[model samples]
Target: MADTLVAHHPLEFVVSELSAASGSAVTLTPEPFLPQHIVRLPAGSATAAVAAQLQLPTAANTWSRTADGRAIWLGPDEWLLVGSESTDAAASAARERELLDLVQTVGGAVTDVSAQRLGIRLGGPKARTVLAKGCSIDLHPKHFGIGTAVQTVLGQAGVVLLALPPGADGHPEYLVLVRSSFAGYLATWLLDAALEFTSSSSAAR
Candidate 1:
């Protein structure tokens, strides 16, 4: 019976239409079901022990790829572990348990938050421009270069935004992690704003 269950993308209803109707200068793809965990380390405690176990970005507003996934620094005492896309529930559960054990040993905590948010991969020449319409933070390369991660507000939605490497189009790419409830709204709003840039495309849902 468990095997009969199906996993659906949060934006399943709108992604296809959004992709077909999006502007030429922008590409939006849903990175559904990425394994995400919230890591909290108490102040000045076991930071060294934790570092010995996992590779993490200790600096504020930055992230680094680890052997497992990307570890993003959320605050001096908080981090976000974002793993590759996976649908294996058993494997994810095992991972959560492993992390929980690790954190418990070091007096920290790990919270499995995979289902709490959705990841939207946004890229292309107008990617930053499109984001600028809704995001107040400066996304210029000089400021928010590759590997930068920050928690910010995008179009009224609270998000953990990451600036990834440039795409083949020679422009920046980005990953936006927003609450699942607001994903549809953000996707629709993005496509609507991008309509002016690509008049030939159809209307966004």
Candidate 2:
């Protein structure tokens, strides 16, 4: 018999509602669920071994991506490994376990945080402006450009903000990672902030 398959995505119920409110100046999309492996290596240990197992960046707040997965450096010894959700569920699960095993080999601790966090993609011409309504960071291009990632608060919710490379039309895109519990609140806050921009863009056209 084939293995039983189960699907779970925290943002499933609200994604459609949020997407409906998206507009030209600022579009929001719930990122497809992905497997996330978070690891914490021992202090003073050789990170090269861990990096060898998973292509992780040594610098803080930086991320490295390979064909199979992406790794984000959260702190001196903390890293988050994320696998592409576009792959088959079984393959993604296998990859997550493989990554966890590799971390164990390096004497590091790993946890599967796939369901603990939710992702939202906020993109378009007014993307930055929308985020600025809540975040206090200086999001100017020179200060927070591509590859930059930071933990910040957005409308009372803690989130990891990643500055993704601009889209083909030169519009900025930001990937916001928030706790599953706060996903709804953040989504609503974001949609509210984007309303003015969308309206102005429509009126100008």
Candidate 3:
């Protein structure tokens, strides 16, 4: 059995700990929506709507939005109507109701899952190698470029993976969004697997 209380070792790869202060964990359930991306007709009146929306443009198979955003394509035909966190959900709900009233059809459903999911960031020269131990996806920059968001299985947990802008410090970093309930489990697994590499760095010192 692996010793859980192994003393920390000095190593080349620094371990930065990130944790949410709230001891309470979050549970995230995927609220699948139909018509993933949203396309806006250029002629539509923008002021008639109560909330702000961001238009994400797709380029090179990545999600992006321009300055003065017009429409956002979250997936294929579904686009999230972006709004401030302070904005009332009732207003958005009203908007959804209005859309339904106009079309008299179910367009998309919004589910509240704020309690679930924890966001984490990991990056370093050895980051890619460390991540490869559990993830099946090719994490190489050549294959998984920046701005990419992928949902895949990682360490027996469903994870929402996103590639962010490169580090200005010239290091590689990947953004990991995992269910808060599984956050501790996944973190322990990752750190445990990294022990050898972490220990090796100390041995080299």
Candidate 4:
């Protein structure tokens, strides 16, 4: 008999619900599931060693990306390494193992948390407006720009918000990292908040 496959993402059950909602002002979609490796680097770890291992950012609340993965700074000595999935299952597994080895070489502890969290992408002209309804952080471009990241609360759920490169229209895009359990709740909350904008946009047309 074949081994039981248990891998699943929280948003797998809600794709239809998300797709039915209007996306005029802000669009919400689940990011392609990927392998996320969380690492806790100890204090006093050499900056050069950490960078050599994973392109760790030098500043707090920032992220650096490589061809296959991205490294986000969670705090002074902690980081989250997220790896993109490859077409081949075996290739994906190999890439994950390679990242694990890199962190281990630097004496950092690592955890495969790919299933523990969900990635949500929020974009469109009014993306920031929709987020401001629930998030306390100042989403102004002057305060938060590409490469900025922060762990904060969004509608009673804890999340990691990362500012990605803007869209062609210069509108901001944000990647919200939420626990798997809270994925549905946050998605609903966001859609509800977005209704106001969607309705207004429809009226103007």
RMSD of every candidate to native, in Å, equals 2.8, 3.2, 12.0, 2.7
Per-candidate local distance difference test: 0.83, 0.80, 0.48, 0.79
lDDT of 3 by residue, 1-205 (tens): 9876532222212223322111112111122111111233232244113112333444433545343222333454343332323224455455445544432222333433333454456655666676778899998888887767666777887876766675655666676656766766777666655554554334667
Top candidate (lDDT) = 1
lDDT of 3: 0.48
Output the TM-score of candidate 2.
Answer: 0.86
TM-score against truth, every candidate: 0.90, 0.86, 0.55, 0.86
User: What's the residue-level lDDT of 105 in candidate 1?
Assistant: 75
Give the 10-residue window scoring lowest on summed lDDT in candidate 1.
196-205
lDDT per residue (tens digit) for residues 139-162 in model 2: 998998888888889988999998
Candidate 4: tens digits of C-alpha lDDT, residues 1-205: 9998765667777777667554667778887777777777766647468665578886998888966678899987778877766234555566667766766665767776777778888888888988999999998988899999999999889999999997665678999999989998998888887876675447777
Compare the candidates by TM-score and give the number of the best one: 1
Which candidate would rank higher by lDDT, 1 or 2? 1
Runs in model 2 lying further than 4 Å from the true structure: 1-8, 43-45, 86-93, 199-205
Error of 2 at 107 (Å): 1.2
Query: Per model, how many backbone clashes are there?
Result: 0, 0, 15, 0
Scored by lDDT, model 1 comes in at 0.83
